[model samples]
Target chain A: MSPSSPSFAVEFDEINQEIVLRGTMRVRSPEEMTDATDLIRRSFGHGGHLVYVNIKRLTHLNMTAFRCIADVLTEACLADPQRRIVIVASSVIAWSAPLFETLASAQPNLSVEIYDSAFYPGQTFVEDESFIPILRTQTKMTWRHEREILPRHGMKEGMAIADICCGIGDFATLIKRQFNPTRLIALDHSKKSLEYARRVAAEFGLNSIEYTYGDASQMLLADNQFDFVTCRHSLQIFDRPDILLRELYRICKPGGRVYITNEKNSHCLGEPHSESIRWTYDEVAKLFSHFDMDVEMGPKSRRLLTDAGFDTIKVESFMVTNLDGDPRDFADVIEAWENVYAGQMAVRRGDSPDFIRRFRQGFKDHVLAALHPKGYAGWPIWAASGRKPF
Target chain B: MIERQVSPEPGAFEQMASLTLDTALFRSEFHLCDRVSEYLADIVAQSHEDPARYANFSSQLINEMIEFSFRSAVPTGQIDFRLLKNEERVRVSIEFAPVSDHQPDWLANDTSAIANGHPAVGDLWGLADAIRVNLHTEEHKENHVTLMADFALLEAVR
Candidate 1:
């Protein structure tokens, strides 16, 4: 057979001193990988003491390709005694870690690191079971607005659906109940969250939701498998929302829609203490930015979807007010946000006590506004969706 | 029948899938290894406790055998692929006709030697202990090699 064309790409991140290899590689000869080998060599010459080779998205590698890449990495290790080469692989791909481990054995300077952990910077803060109630309440508040907004974005019954980064899966359950999709798969990175989701599904007798644990950026799910893909309140927290969005687009079928929701924390408003709440929420946006998350991504949903190669985009904004449900429920959601964002994250970020005190006061005032007899508390969200062109 | 000899017990396992394809067709597409392994792994993994992990693990092991067949089988003969499973182990058996005149070196190597050692890294068969090599030839008959590998279905400790 004529030599198969290169099926992989190697990208070097200069700032991070990392080389990422993505896609399957089944070349007929080592010469086919000359470009990648040369790039890796050039990257090593940049005088970085440590370089990470990320093969997390490398789904397949034949022996010829394996030896080719391994030879380049081995040479790099030997050239610089002080230079350490870390091969970042994921357990999601079964053969990667085991195959690379052999190469690590031969080179003392090389090691294999399994990267199957949190995909988002705020993952730990959000995945804690302590946050489950808050997430459910947040979903409860948002569903009121979203249920009305979903159909305008192409959500309908009997479509194969996937909810990527489904968190506790409350929204998926809600979708199943409301839309009765033909097939619904809910995927999340957090095992604990999936367990809780499965348990909740069982409790609700919703046995059909396939709860799976996987990295959102490199899911094993097949391409063009879902007709309607919904990722809610997720893109804003990931360090690389573009990568996550790309995966969402990949899984969405042609002529199908990919729906997403995000928050512009700075726009969160309450009438009674509007100014204080505004200040705190603006700080919330800044705090998220410090952790490489963009809580201000709500308004940018249209641009993000458009840039991800989706067309016929539909975008809308909604405000979840105290009047949507029990006012105390709204107060409870604000209180949880204050505890996590102001109490934990601010402290973790080493904010001054005065700054934290002021931050805490904003959330408290928002809670007060929610409880006020006639006051209005609003949490604004942007819902945007686009159809993958046929 | 060859799988029964390699497996721990003859009647303990149930067959999941069996296929016979022209080696030329199988070897022509490199991605067939990935596609076949993934398809079979997905089927067997449904009854597994951890379906995702089991599918991943099973896919790798199955791919190894399919890969071996892709490399070693004659350019234009039939290759048989079989997947069998029990509570304890998942077995992949691949049978293909070798060059009619002589046996390949890998089949000639003492299979017991590999079965005894830690699967050596970079060795032709990277996964050694899991594999059992068998060759069958008779008077006036073409020689064939059957490469079988078993993967244990153990609950993850982590």
Candidate 2:
């Protein structure tokens, strides 16, 4: 089909070993375009190859459209065990970039190449050779962290685990691969994220897992369903942290373990920067303490466990060094901190651009200097676990 | 709080309409139609001194009352109202029909139950009282009046 065609067109490029899709895949109301794409993809039987979806002529799209594309790509990748799928798009100019990135991260074999006119004028395709290095770097970093932490917590094979707030199944996938868990139920709120996770699981041939979408606070799983519950950087966002803890307690089997990790003085861990942040932290802290759990502050982790409730509570501290020792890592940390500071300042000033830019730049400089080798700044993360009494 | 002279040549319709408007504007809590009836009765009782003038005033008042009520009840929406006379009384009825694509799920089931209860009954009685008060009032003493009102939900058949 031509680019102007209203319907979708699929063709295989033998030279590039890529499957090229053109034209608007959006069909009329109620009819899913992904279903049509799937039919075409299956007919071609091109397994483990790069898939380039050219949306240059596409004017409109929604979550459903992205989901459909993800489904087709996932199925094709799964069918071919040896090959991987690489996605090439024009740029992150489209709202669908986040959705695409989310899917790529979830699907182990799927890599996305976003083409920018300024970055690469004519090259709009993602090559397999180009993606391998980037993929290897990310995988090694993630795997190293998981391996370091898993053994410390005594995570063993055949353990039934619940991964709370499993965003796109990044940590969940890592945990499953390293620990070789018998069953891994990855839970997240975003349906699109879960769809991506499903794709990843399919691509990796990891079938011993289930994906669920809902609020973790109201997880519908049966009580005592999991031998272990792991939450990574998710506890502080809860309206009632104690309620979540109690829910975790109820769901975990007797003698089961619960692990939670968050960076200290980090936005993700509910640290306060201003009055508003303090107020939010106070409310969250109140919820965390309400469940009658004993609290112990460690060098890395502020551990909370109850002898009356759980048999044991242990808190461990660990440092993650950037093996590359790149200054960009420290810059990224400062940038994240600056973003939080600027956001808070903006709220106070009613979103004035002058105040936001000034505060952000100042905060970034201050944080960057602090994170330098001799600056006495180190990223502090806390990991704690408790065992429910049998 | 303000007083005005009643018009002469008031008729039964005029007395009823004036009573309806007066009751709606004054009473804080009363059945809707009963309030109208009461106002009419009050005007009729007081208009003995200048019957013709009060009669005329009452007719104009009732016309204004009907116009105002019709506008408010329908409110530029698809709500339809009809004034019907049966035997000896004038009955003003209002019907609200669901028109939008997103209709409230419980509207059909609850409207019937709501219409059957004392709340709707009280509103109808208040309207009647207003008519009665106006007919007996000094502004409409020469006119005789009867008033009633009912509410119902109408579903369109496919």
Candidate 3:
């Protein structure tokens, strides 16, 4: 194995409990594939305890190599039904965990978990006036859309609505257009974003949507005034989400719904190994636990509303995909992301510029050349909504 | 300011692929051309391995079209612009309906027919792989025109 070839490098742990596979591995022929299988079997080493195959150190992960590794582990599990295989992959990789999970779904002893090496989600330069539209386009959203997260939450024709931390007011305007809320107040603390939102709304000749500037944790709006309260993709920015949630609950009228959607893949996908903003469902549950909320949910929907003391909670997921192409449209989106990523990294104080530049280029190449043709290029948008007690 | 009623909703022109310049003759001036040209150059620079040649023509094409719109007989409501990717080249297409019945003579004939007399018009042939223009007098008030200029994308630009 060439030390710096970036194709395949294997390092076995002295304890023999774990094996770290690094770099992009491709099997050119069946012989090479068989060799990779033998190496993985060697790593298992007649083990009775759970064996870990760590792909977290891989610079550019190749799924083919991992599939081979998974096959070896499956045969091992057949030999010893109690032997467990833990595949530790970086949180940034889109397909690694899912692909492994699918492979392991059949076998009882195999599992995949995201290593907590994600970048810290921060108030990126996305707050800048110019960036809001490009970011929204990445998610295939407009100022207002007939198709939305609103009607699904039971928004009516003329009820009052408030969008907290509503950067650029895209979702708020969308709700107003789709549902015709009697009073649509779009609120955000950032002057730049609020101004942009106001200008956009004005451009649309929309006078009904009101723009207010205020922090989510300390909104000046009255309680029980809004029919619906929503905050999307901004929950991670608050120093304390618990305070914001309590405020969301306070302002929400009895039986009114509160919806919280986390942009999971956006925050975690392409996250670096050094930092983590990959808030797991458990982390989200723990974060809200301080406020005595319990939304231990499913893959797409978690019952955060139930934890927030709301009855009749429903969790829904929205995903935008089949965009551009594998390398073509995907490359463009990644480049658009690169436009904001450096500034976001700077905001988080995460990695050095050198490291970020390298990762950005490497990820583009990996996605373009090695990733599956119909791979995961989208973030899982999970929304949890529940009503206040009537 | 032009009465451009565009919401944050995705416009026909979105992202780096295209940008719409829907301003009145009084607003755009020479500054619009320079600013948009610079933006196009930046896009080409970022997208191409070697941007020097493609960037040059993109600026020239943008300037001439803005000149074409500015010199139109009447004020036009909107002139749409897009940079599209063809199989082998990038096509910069500009669509607008000028409020004039008299077709612009510059576009009436092949650019080379008057190349010597109008060097700026002559430069079009050198800068583009193909120049396709569609002009039809709309019965309402304006003459619809679509100018599509294809530039060399090479292996680098894609």
Candidate 4:
């Protein structure tokens, strides 16, 4: 009942046939648990069949809270037997949705719906409003990168290919269209991202591809299954990149190809913020070498491939122009770059927020200018392809 | 290495106890203790008012109390197989130490007593047995526990 207290607040609109429940429903507190239970009862009592849980402001719910909410929703659905519970939240909550969905699915009556607010207008940052278009542009650019590199490595139709960390299914769709591979497995850890990829592939009517959720380093696939393995802009996430690259090597058939693309270590661009960028690139390069895999570093990543135990490695670089004339696209890119810079600065400071604001702002400004048109708003994207020796 | 009897100071016990409580280094063990404590506390309070509830809860409370004490002394870390000299029973030691400067006073005192006890006569074999049971169930194949045992020794040097 206390407005300041952390408890679930429910509102039922009978005419609209909607039930909205908001607030932090964590089980760490008894009040929150009681409020959550009450919300479910009140919503169901009002003949409000369609339920919409707005979790935009609800932050920090533990596994216990998740279970409690899931149980209440499940019980309510069983009573009605035809009601659906819709969850609307930011894309940050996408990872947690699978856990909730799994819990809800335990009961036959309940159907869980998760809607990412980014796909909706006005909810996300003004700059991020154009994310779909930017993602589409990036997807297209990745395909172009793949096209230029794949054929150079002698990739052909009917070959078994694995696309590791296939974001938005861009490379998978591209390979399906270009090479028409015999069996293409597109694997990514993010199920929501994979869902988008799946829908896009389904729309394109591509059926040869299979999707799997897994870590690239410890793929569940059988050894020596893939003729070629392709990864784009995903090598940075691996805590042990060497292990993943070695696994990629093991999976490829003798004489099969491996194609990898990453944003070139910006030290080659001679940007003002290139020191940190160079360190990240060096760390990645070290991992590649540790695996005894050949690598081509710099504006051309073909050298990385050559050093990574590959006999023949080729490198190519291209620039993606964000010249859609939409200031929003430029702003989005700037925001993303700012986030990256902020994260780096935080890590350097051991996650302390005591640094001078002026210094941080100056770094942000330098990065934005270097990335924008005034200083050549183009990043050196590298593509390298190499053939594994028999 | 020479056999040494290190007498931990009173302040050391206080520090260890504070650390244990603050960091919950023995959270699993403490949770079992808490359950036993709560049940016993309720029964004791209720016995003053109503004896029937106390009588009904006594058996369960006793079992939980025994289990709790046993877990507190045993190492919850990785299980290593070893044969005790001339004995058919296997001897397993699961080592744990409070990582924080704050641990519960009673628990810390109990731990110190057990650690510094005479080699021939152990203070609490029942407590050690409970810990072994918990460790056997919880310890993974690659379990590793890095204890801050040197902290008190270093402080003594200072």
lDDT by residue for model 3 (A6-72), tens: 2456766747577777544533223566766787787777444788877664533233344466567
**lDDT per residue (tens digit) for residues A185-215 in model 2:** 7776554566667787789987667676534
Let me know the TM-score candidate 1 reaches against the reference structure.
Answer: 0.87
lDDT, model 3: 0.53
Alpha-carbon lDDT of model 1: 0.78
**How should the candidates be ordered by lDDT, best one leading?**
1, 3, 4, 2
Off by over 4 Å in 2: A1-143, A266-303, A322-330, A333-337, A340-359, A366-377, B1-158
Candidates arranged by TM-score, highest first: 1, 3, 4, 2
Estimate every model's Cα lDDT from 0 to 1: 0.78, 0.45, 0.53, 0.47
Cα TM-score per model: 0.87, 0.39, 0.41, 0.40
lDDT of 4 by residue, A1-390 (tens): 011123445666666555555443333323557665676667777765566655543432433355456567777877877766665543333223444455455666554565543321211221232334455556664454557667877788899999987756777888898899988888765555667777888888985577655445544344567798987765543434455676577678779888877764333232445454344444434433443322333343454465567768777776654343443454455455445434443344343454324334544544454455554344456777778998
lDDT of 1 by residue, A1-390 (tens): 101222578999999899999866756557888998899889889849899999988865666677678778988998997999999987666667777887787899999999875557988788888998888999999998899899999899999999999999999999999999998989887778888999999999998888877778767676787899999888999999999998898888889999999999999999898999999999999999999999999999999999999999999999999999899999999999999998899999999999999999999999999999989999999999999999
Candidate 4: where is the Cα deviation over 4 Å?
A: A1-137, A268-308, A321-331, A340-375, B1-158
- Candidate 1 vs candidate 4, DockQ winner: 1
Candidate 1 residues B48-93, lDDT tens each?
A: 5446556655665566556656766688878887778887766677
Candidate 1 vs candidate 4, TM-score winner? 1
Off by over 4 Å in 1: A1-7, A116-118, B1-7, B49-53, B100-102, B108-124, B127-141, B151-158
- The worst-scoring run of ten residues by lDDT in candidate 1 chain A lies at A1-10
DockQ of 1: 0.24
